[model samples]
Target: MGRVKVLGACPLDCPDACSWVVTVEDGKATGLRGNKDHPVTRGALCVKVNRYLEQVGSPDRLRYPLRRVGPKGSGRFERISWDEALDEIATRLTGIVAGFGAEAIWPFHGTGSLGYLQGLEGYPGRRMFNVLGASHHAATICSVAGGTGLRYTLGTSGGMDPEDFARSKLILLWGTNPLTSGHHLWKFVQDSGAYLVSIDPVRTKTSERCDEHIAPLPGTDAALALGLLHVIVSLGAQDERFIAEHTEGWPEFRDRITEFTPERTAAITGVPQEQIVALGERIARTRPTAIRASQGMQRHAGGGMALRVLACLPGVTGDWAIPGGGLHYSTSGHFRLDDAALVRDDLLPHPVRTLSMTRLGEALLETDDPPVKALFVIGANPVGSNPDQRRAIEGLSRDDLFTVVLEHFATDTVDYADIVLPATMQPEHLDVIAGYGHLYLVWNEPAVEPPGECLSTTETFRRLSHRLGLTEPALYDSDEELARQLLKGHDLDRLRADGFLKIQPGSVPADKLQFVSTRAELAGHDPLPDYTPPADKGDGLVLISAASHYFLNTSFGSNPELRRRAGDSTITLHPDDAAARDITDGAAVLVSNARGAFEAVAEVSDRVRPGVAATTKGRWAKFTDGATVNATIAERDSDYGGGAVFHDNRVEVRPR
Candidate 1:
């Protein structure tokens, strides 16, 4: 009879797992706002999420299951019943398994939802896929490279808590623009009243606000880090006691950095020698200095090495023993969830090959053992998110591939699907989320009923399990059961009563810091910190496909207001680079490389370095000219994990 409020959490692939409150009236969500009680959220939501109601109520919401009626990529479909769609999907999957084997079926997913029950790590379809002996999906498009790199030096990605940033004396924002992506972390950095330094090739919005901005040539972060460490050691500022007590292989790491003098580092990184010396001095003297190293910096060929070297900074300075000191690449390591229970990989028939999601094109087209015949897409849009857009689209266009997509809207990936199933959004689903930014476990209660025929991902997989004649009990577990299983040891009662709960008590332990890692050596890499320049360094301008302020990796690419605010698909260029090619501000230009090319409007500015060009990612093909910015990106792997090299490519930008 009246409006009521319900507690939930933002389920997007963001660091801030913001606890939010939804106002409901007549079983429909009327309004949503950030939870003021949450420390990181602080009663604020990002600009992109402020208009989320429109996204849920958009006219384009896919309300019913549909079957493709036209050729692939035609976006033509006819409405179909759930039974019909599931029966057809089951029939096709059975045929593919009979002919090519279960390895031919790829259940591709991504970070669209970070919910433990429905999102990337949750594995909503993992049980059925494991029971059928399906190939594993290596979700490496995001933080894997950095996480692996951090592991080399620290043994874990867990580092200084973001809440402890308020205790820091200095903070380094390395290749991250919190104003655009991790805004919640910014509040702590500001609260510390610490000297802020932004280290990035692009003079981002956050960089402009920093106390100092140090622009280095992209892909040379390891050299810069070593150079800084060299200066620290020369100044005799390294914590000898910390090195002797907590770290291993310090002698080798120290010797390795001896060659990375300020002059030598400047030559490689394009940062001025004087600035490097000054910043190095500052870092050496500053106590409890924290570095917020995000995923953006580790998206290159040598991404893992870069993070490894950077992580050594705190260990050298003995900052790891302080409240605010350490490197934070990710905080997911702190949450000890029951992963075995969540995915149930033990049910797999036998060992199956794992395919890299970063190299989706190769998995679908060039895979020889059993070529991918069926693709089940959930919580991701590859055409807009994956690198090598040309190859991914080509593979998706294959007529023989049986594709089924579960989505809220008809995305670029949906066009290539043989069957499109409408899936419930966050407000219509129950999930438990852990923030990679903060140390909180959030509970998301379903606020509204699913619109039209939309079903939750867990429900969809359960139906598929039944339709496939599978009798696995775990596969058919209810949402409540799955949640209870995932939250076995955690204080679920407090979390439900308060909407959130801190999973851990304090900052990372001092013993967690290690200067050198034998694990890296065992992996055939140098055990000590070092720099390796990217192999793709040619005489062309470097391309930086950075994140957008208004979109979360293609999740909000369809919002009209957000799109308008994002403006045209534009490439930002240095004034010198623009003048060299006779390109003017707001002029249409073409960015091309050996991989592929796309058109964009030019914005001549000094935001980027002379030899670098920048563009925001998440432009859908239909949003622009049938090609997204990813067309120019290669599907190359980083050194540690098979992470995509999104920022390691060289491209040519010219007037169209």
Candidate 2:
């Protein structure tokens, strides 16, 4: 019996790029643990990832290629050879291009594995799709709105390093609950000894631990930010020197901020005037304050504007010049991947229309010119995660639509596929991983051979490209070649030895905190940092479908242990709202809107505001009734970045 430890990195769709050690005994994985040497990992894995071995070793994992034998969404398939699967996929895609043009083919990708080679951002099928002139997929489900807004103000989303948060005297957890979703960064927050404050609509686990929890109305973040700025300027806390030297359009912005006084902000945000005043005063007095604005906060109709307004707070206080004082949305901009070399967009024969993934149902159902005939789903389950679930499912049910999915499990999206290819998991594949939460890139080494005939996404695409008989040299590049191309000008040996590479943040004067007056013009917004109210105000409680602690966007949704720990799909409402609806805790309820409906167990609590209903996302349709919270969300786009408005939804809750 022999035991060995292999170094690898996590490739899940998380901000923390965790470095881990896999314990293998007799050629089988015995255990897995975090690398204590890595500052972000700190020798611990989150609750979701702690039980990842279950996911890797699950009996339900797809080990062989499948061809659907029953109707769509039947979850019935017959085992097939890789040659059969790849041949069928290539033939169907070629037929689709010949009959309906290449624009009919959509390569739908997602952030299942945030690796440079296998994930959505890596452009998994870029060379083939571009060479074939297929329609472009706009990846805007997650942080695009917030990142776009931050870029307009700060010229980049990269800001204060997570390690520098320990130097802060005040830390504002703005719409981000790092303890549940991103537990690694909490170590630095704990070490900071900072007066922590949580600004969210619901009292999350992180909020309960914070020194202050200010529950504002949903979709009213911009109002709260403007109100804070109003108080800062009123108290003469504004840094005149920084504003003069570093900012733009302050006079106009100040004039706009004046409109949002404490009383007005309290009315708009549903936060008490006194609480707003006190928090504003605290912000004015606190030096080296850090604001961590997450992706969830910018998932509303005015989400982009909300981020733009929140980003101005640091400039108003001159926190940009100090350590642990800037607004941190993401550190992804620092990692410069050779995207042109990898994506090969130059191979395109002509310009192709870009379709938004957020409005996937529309793209699938309502698109007219060259209706979508072929869908190549890569590492994404849109039927379970995308908005307007009914339309997505209905569109997928089309008998004429030829669909192919690359997945590890029989996900909701896989149920509707014509060909389902089994893909390798993190431990069974090689990838170059980067994180948005911190500044580091980890080389994910394959710890074990893939089970059965499973293949990595890169290998799958390479094989499919060959089966198509296309002479695209870039499409046939090896995984190692792709990794080296992405890690250009970096030490490969050092990266392999250390298991990670630190990406130094870019050094540019324009990268500093600076507001742009032209930002409002880009999205037809206000002249200055202004509040754009939610489009829908007509009815019942505002629904917020946030990230779950047990699941990472349907990645581990099939794990029995994780599912048991997560319990049934639940919707948490304030006691007052529950009483008004004549609903009791633990009762089955129906949450419905104009878009659709779903079933959930009601949890009556004071954790959420009266007019707000809260629930965690990423539950499978089979786990719940026939839909998840996504069913109730409309196909609406944010004011900026064409992002999904998941939080801008309104729904009614009643006894089932």
Candidate 3:
């Protein structure tokens, strides 16, 4: 046996961008640990990183490319050679383009694979589609709403570094559970001397550790933010000089927020008037107060407005000038990947149709003249992640549509695929990752040759490009070359030598008080964060879905150990609400809404508000009994950001 080979950079589709030192003997991975030298992750990793070997070596992993031998959505396929697979895909896509024009073909992808080659950067999918003049999807499924809202208020959503948490005097965890979803960030928060406050519909693991937990009604975040602003202004906390100098439309914004008194906000948000007043006072009293807002708050009908309102808090108090005070969102800046440069339109033969990622099912099933004849899916699980699983299934089940899925395992999406291409595991590929939550761009070297016939996404695309005669020499370059291209203006040599790179921090202008007055404000929108309730609020209990630490969508759900760790999907309800519905803890209950229904074990607790219910997302589709959480969520979105309103749904629960 030789010395174990440690691999850095294993893609888990997570924001951590974890660097792993894989202990290998005789070409077999023995164990894994976090690379202490990695800049972003430091020496830490979540529980998932340790269990990656099991996932990579799982028996369920796809070993070879396979073509469907039975009906679509049926898990029946026969193994095919790489040549045959590439040939088949190329032929089908060409025919689709020739007949329906380039717009008829759609490439659906996201953060499934963190490597630049597989995602938006290195892949030719978007380039080909764009060159072909295919309809381009806006592609803002996750953070678009928050991004839009923040853009309007602050010009950008960027905030303080996670490491700077140690400097904060007051930390407001709004609609996020860093303890679970953001484990590493939680460590910084724990060590920080900051007084922690958690606000959400449910008392998450994060809330449990907080100094105070405020359970607000779902979808009322904007109202609460307005109330807080009202308190801050009323208590004379506003930086009037800064507000007058830096911001635009201040008079109108001030006039607008004057009506959002604590009493008025209490009724709208379901938070006690005293709690609102106390929180407002805390914000006013605390120096360098920081607010951490996540996607949770932006998954409602008026979610974008909520984020905009929350972002205005720090600015209103001139908190953005402080090292640890500001509204924080995504950390995608730590590892910068310029997508526009990678997309070359000259390579494609025609224009392609655009599709909405949010309406994946509808797009797939649409019977337009040319139709969505062919689909190329990479690094995403639309069936599991998209809203309305039943509709997604029906769309994928279309007999005439040809589908290709590149994955390591048989996901819910794979069952409907016409061709399943085996994909290399993270440790088996050479890649680079930049976290959206922290500052670090870590390089990952392959620990072992790709097992069996599996290939990396880059290799797959390269082979397909060669077969299609797309004469672009750059498309066939090595991963290293591609990485270099992707990191064009960035310092690649420094990143390589240091094992990570941190970008220079940008500054928020000194005079800007809030969204309306800041240069960072988004175009075609009011500068101040505004709020209005959704048009529809159904009768009965409101449903909200949150992320699960154990699973990333349905990927890790197949793992028995991970499944054991996650346990069964349970519906969380307030004790009083459960009793009123004649339900008890541990009892099987039926959760139904206008869209669909599902059954699960009920847990009654005071952690949640009386009118609301909560459940973790990323459970296996089969466990929902044909009804997933997205089914109940309305497809309607915030007008400004186009964010899905997952938390605005109203459902009823009954004893099953």
Candidate 4:
């Protein structure tokens, strides 16, 4: 009867990388809880990660290698040894490279883990393919659009820490549901005792808890920001001193915003003219104000431009000089780490062709020249998460396309695999995890032996590279060695022992102002933030596929307790919209658009405004009654950064 507690971190693709402690008794993990020592996590995990032991010890976890025994898209397989699986994969890939060149082998991956080493696109796993001269993947499935847009406006993405929200006098939560995703940040916002205002198309769970909630039309946030700017400048609230001393091209920006008066913006954003004016005045007058945005805003046609315009609020109001007073889109770029040392792009065999991850369906189905011959996937569920699920799945079902997936569960993507390799859960790997929402970098350590014959992604690829006979000394670095090398800017010893470290923010030139112009300025498009309408427009209703409180992207979509709480997938619409469409509550309704469509039970609610149907992401095809929600989404790229325009989707809903 022996019990021991081991420290670890939740390495999911979350902004708050929570530190945790695992209780192992009799050589088995018995309990898990958040580490009280972690300032950001504050001894509490989200609803999803709280039941992670079930995920780690789930009966359905893949414990062995598998080979297809039935038709594609069917969950049928026969167990195979690691050696046999590796040999077959190596031989097939070898034949592929020899016949069609290394570029033919397209390696697809996503943020299955956020660990510095093990998670985030299966780091070292891609090293093998890179040295093999495989096709280059533009991993912009998420965040890139918003992150890039904000960076262009702010000079750098560095901003106030989430914990610093307590110092603010007013907080604007725009396009973010902090209660579900950024819980720690929400706590600070609450503690600040400031006026909490939420501006989102949906009256989200977080909006429900806010002092005020303002619903704007999807893809129209730029108009909202511009409207605010018009009020701020007209009412003499613009920070004249800061603008004269630190900023560039303020005259053009000011004149340009006058066109976005409350009435004009109201027509665009669907918010009342009076509400827009009131909100704008409140923000301008509020000292030590902060605007915390989400990556979701960038998942639209005009997403990049929206963030760029929104970032200007702080500069106009002089919030950048004050702690916890600037716009906090992400504190990710503030942290320093040796990323080149970790991924080692210098090891690439040669320059390679590029493919867009946002348009996976097109890349898989329409890619030419040497077209993608063989597919190797790791740490991603593209079938469920990627837009145009039907096309993505159709490509996966191709008899010619040899597909492989490395995962811990038999996900929808795994069902179509020619080979399925077992992967270790978070507690079975090593990582130095960073957070976009916090200041601490957490050390993730294994708490128990992995179930079945699972292998870490790095080790699996390292073994495959050996089998393929590519002997670069750099390719064979141990996980510990890799971890130590990537941790140059931070204290390795302190992080290893204490399980967490508070990272200091990066320094930018004060004279440059927080906002740095990217290029030549003309009508807010060049050096200044611009407003661009979405290219796609539907006739009937608007559809937004966003993350539910239960799932973060596609990570923990299968846990029993979590999934039970999440209940079954359904489309939520305002009661008014449902009534107008003659859609009854709990009745099946068909939601469709030009790209594709899906059917879900109606849950009439005001979680989202009228004409907007809201549902969750990460539900696999098997979990859904019909097609996955992503099927209704287009495989479109954003205005900047090649990000997926998930929120830009438009659809019509009616009784099925």
Candidate 5:
């Protein structure tokens, strides 16, 4: 028996690139756990990663390359040799390029494979496509809007570490519920000793545990944020000295917030005027106050503006100077890694045409002339995650188009593919990870050989490149060489010895008012936080798509344990709303909008605000006639970032 080595870092979309330890008996992996010696994660494991054994060895896993035996989206396929699959894909794709312009071919991908090497920058796909002048995709689905907003206000999107939460006197969990989505950061929140204030339209698990819960009207977050700023300024709590020294646009920003009196903001936000005043006073009076915004606020129309408004709070009070008092969008310490050096741009012949992942439906179906002739889906399941199920299905169902999916299982997106390429799980690959939420860079070693012909993403690309006749210097190398190249200029000996590397820390400004003077130094847009209201408040009820505690998109929906934990999708409605509609808990109800309708189990809970309905977003599409929660959402996007307006939808629900 030999100690099974756990490779640190796996999963493309996750921020916590945790290290795992494998136990091997007779050359077979028997168990896996977190590497306790890793300082950042500290041996913590999320439920998704804990079930690696089943995921890697499941009988349902895709074990070999398979080509379509029937029509597209038919889920009928016949096993094909790897050589045949690669050769056929390359030949067909090349022909499409020869006929149509490079822009005619769109490669749609998202954050599913966050590893720089496995995805855009590190992968040879971008290089190959660029050389062929193929269409490129702009990976801006989840955090781009929020990232843009932060870049405008803070100069940099990176923020203070989550472990520094212990130094705060007050922490406002604005529109973010970390208990469910970011469990790794919860430890610091729980130990912070600060008063937790949850301000959201729904009463989530994070809100339930907070010292105070402020339920604002949907899309009225900017109004609430402005009202608080007004109160802070009125009380003379603004850090004038810090502002004068660090920031630039104070006078104009101050004048803009004058209109957001507590009374005026309360009317629009559904929060009490007195409560707003008190919260503002507390934020100003607290020795060190922190405001945390999450992706939820960035999912609606004007979402970027909402986040920009919230980012100004820390600046107004000069809270950024405090160790724990600052605006934090993410604590994943990915910026510490020298990504520029790791990204080998010269490997590609030219830049590929790009498309936005958020508007995948539009990009795939609405393109003029030679539309997306072939799609290579890797590390993403847009069929389940993209908004508007009808539109996504229509886009993916191009009759003449060929689709290929590289996956570990038969996901909702796999059914639409013409070919399925078996992919290896995390423990079966050699890789490196730079966690965005933490400062650890992990060296992922192959704990076990890929089972039954499963291949790493790097391997898949290597074979594909070979078939395509790509002769670039970078594309012709092995995975180990790629890793070494990416890790260039670093202390590799140290990383290999510890199995991880923590980037050296740097000096961060301690003066909360630094931005007041250094506003011009920030990265993008207006430095001062700004506020804007939603375009419309429809007569129909407002709908919000939130994540569940048990699943991450549609990826884990099929996991038996997770499925048991999250039995079925249910609509959470306020008692008043449910009663008005004659709906009761456990009753089946039809939720409909202009796009389409679907039946969902009703769970009448006061967790939601009146006139607002809530449901989990990542359930399987087949939950009800291929009915997805996103189907009820329109393509209406935010004015600034064009982010999906999931929170701005209007729908009606009735008993089924």
Candidate 6:
């Protein structure tokens, strides 16, 4: 590979799965940048992804397999051959299965590497483990509540394209900081000349740029949505024609929201009554308004209900029928790939137990009947990402438990692993990527080979299956075959040539909706969402583990350059709250609740609401003095999707 240009896609889990152009020189990639022809990414990359070439070839990259040679969590290991590592893993897993049954073994992974082959819905690794009858991972840490709840009203999470934002007169930047997370889409919103409104508990970068910033109380988004509906109903602005043609439960829903008046909504949410009335009027009067809902708002106890209510707003204004309208949660459903072809669930010997990845601490420490004895961790760093961090670490420290991790760097989770295997990056692997924000479908091809003994996630699983004596043909499926399966309707040769293709193609907006008649996807689900109060509330302040601009949930935290720019994991508090507690700005403080505690430097400012405290989450323990926000975060599940309630954390803060 000498001075060759290679087309690829970003494998990180994000709305904008950007397409990239990699410059390979002397058998290694020298430069990586966004593809100018790509529509959503628009020849630009985020702060974390812009330095992709540097990150892939970092000095600290794990290049070979290693076995623990010191105490657990000591970050000590001895180099080992891939064959020996796989053999030992196979032997230990077999023993665990023989003694504790298949349910005792769990495969832990996340969207850190979200390529179609290596991402969420498995191409081979999932099939191999399903054949082996390992515990089913609910993989609900992110996107669960937003996807599940939006479907309850819209029947599908797919909606108007981010490009459609150019046609809108109004936009709601709800619960998301698109400036950092979806930077590409933010340009479309800005160019559209739309009146942007931001709704969040703190004054985020998106909020600061908005024409109106509505700071609602944490977990009170459902109530605020209901209040908007109340004002719309009172003004008789409901789209009756669209309602008569497409909706069913409008009357019942109308009656239910009579209780949530604007005044009541103002009381529930911290926003003023006048602002609620004004915002509701804008929503009712605005044409082709798009509600850009994010997953953070739904990280509360009532996360599911909030999205359900937000999903129904488009129906009231008939926004679903227009360009730059309707709610955009995720466009992942638009791919319509042959999942059965990629994931061979039929190979399972029988149905196995399902474990929620959000409850890893409980699964490891509390489960009695065949507790998780063997765990294979990949594509995630649970010690830094999962809730109840202390408890999860305590469980990982158990002598009888065996843990395996595959990675490019020694993450906090790798510190406790019995066997650590070297893993390949996107530039050195093959996979496909689809956007949750745009209509593009990208194919990521290998640009360069792994430098050392590093291997792809799919190859690692195939090798392990071979060593375990698993003889399923499905376990040996090729990457190209799975890629062909996903690109069934499209022209394969053209897709390969372009390196990207639009999954949803249409000249009209209605083309996205599968059900023109608005109704819940599942039976027994409330067609009309109700206003639910906060689950955890008190006189004490609420702490939200907000996402940092440079780091995506424990994925890019290992990058030293990115870490330097992110600064420390400091907490921000309202001046009133800080004054009441006598806490000084920039001083180290304890953010604690009944369940757990963590330390953070406090920044006393009025940017946050009086009753709320906010801090950037996903900092690794090593950078933060063996501390993280997850230490205090409860393992509470969302209302419906079994999602982790990361924002449902309530704590009292005081200077140390």
Q: Which of the numbered candidates is closest to the native, going by highest lDDT?
A: 1
Weakest 10 consecutive residues of candidate 2 by summed lDDT: 507-516
Candidate 3: residue 293 Cα off by (Å): 0.9
Itemize residue pairs with steric clashes in candidate 1: none
Q: Candidate 2, residues 1-656: lDDT per residue as tens digits? A: 59988888888888898999898888788899998888799789888888888888899999999999999999899999999998899889889889999999999998888888888768787888898999999999998888877777877777778888999999999999898888888889999999999999999999999999999998999999999888999999999998898888787788888999999999999999999999999999999899988889999988988988888998889988888787888888777778788888899999999988888889888997899999989989999989999999999999999999999999999999999999998888888888888998887888888899999999888888899998978889898888888778888778888898788887422544546557657657665667889987879999999889999998888888889989988999999999999999999999999889999899999999889999999889977768999998888899878998899989999998
lDDT (Cα, tens digit) per residue for candidate 5, span 57-117: 7888999999888766678889998988998998888888788766676667655656656
lDDT of 4 at 133: 89
Candidate 5: residue 506 lDDT (0-100): 38
Residue pairs in steric clash, candidate 6? none
Q: Model 4: per-residue lDDT, tens digit, 1-656?
A: 59998889988877898999999997799999999989888899988888889899989899999999999998899999999999999999999889889999888867888776777733547678888989877788888888777666666676677788999999999989888886888778878999999988888888888899999888899889999999988899999997887677788778778889899999998899999999889988889898888888778888877887877788888887788788787778887788888787787868888887778789778887787888887788998789888899888888888898999888888999999999988888887788889888888888788888999888888889899998888789898889888887678988989999998877422235534464424324456566778766757767777787888777777766677888777899899998898988898888887667777889998778876778888776787754778888888888777899888877888898
After aligning candidate 4 to the native by TM-score, how far in Å is the CA of 241 from where it should be? 1.3
Candidate-wise lDDT, in order: 0.90, 0.88, 0.76, 0.83, 0.74, 0.84
Candidate 1's residue-wise lDDT over 81-161, tens digit each?
Answer: 999999999999999999999999999998889999989878789999999999989999998888888877777778768
TM-score of predicted structure 6: 0.96
lDDT of 1: 0.90
> Which of the two, 2 or 4, has more lDDT?
2
Better of 2 and 3 by TM-score: 2
Alpha-carbon error at 429 in model 2, in Å? 1.3
- How displaced is residue 134 in candidate 1, in Å? 0.6
The TM-scores of all predictions, comma-separated, are 0.99, 0.98, 0.95, 0.97, 0.94, 0.96
Q: What TM-score does prediction 1 earn?
A: 0.99
lDDT of model 4 at residue 115? 72
The lowest-lDDT stretch of 10 consecutive residues in candidate 1 is 505-514
Answer with 4 or 5, whichever has the higher TM-score: 4
Rank all candidate structures by their lDDT, best first, as comma-separated numbers.
Answer: 1, 2, 6, 4, 3, 5
Task: Write the number of the candidate with greater TM-score, choosing between 1 and 6.
Answer: 1
Clashes of each: 0, 0, 30, 0, 29, 0
The true-versus-predicted C-alpha distance at residue 452 of model 1, in Å, is 0.7
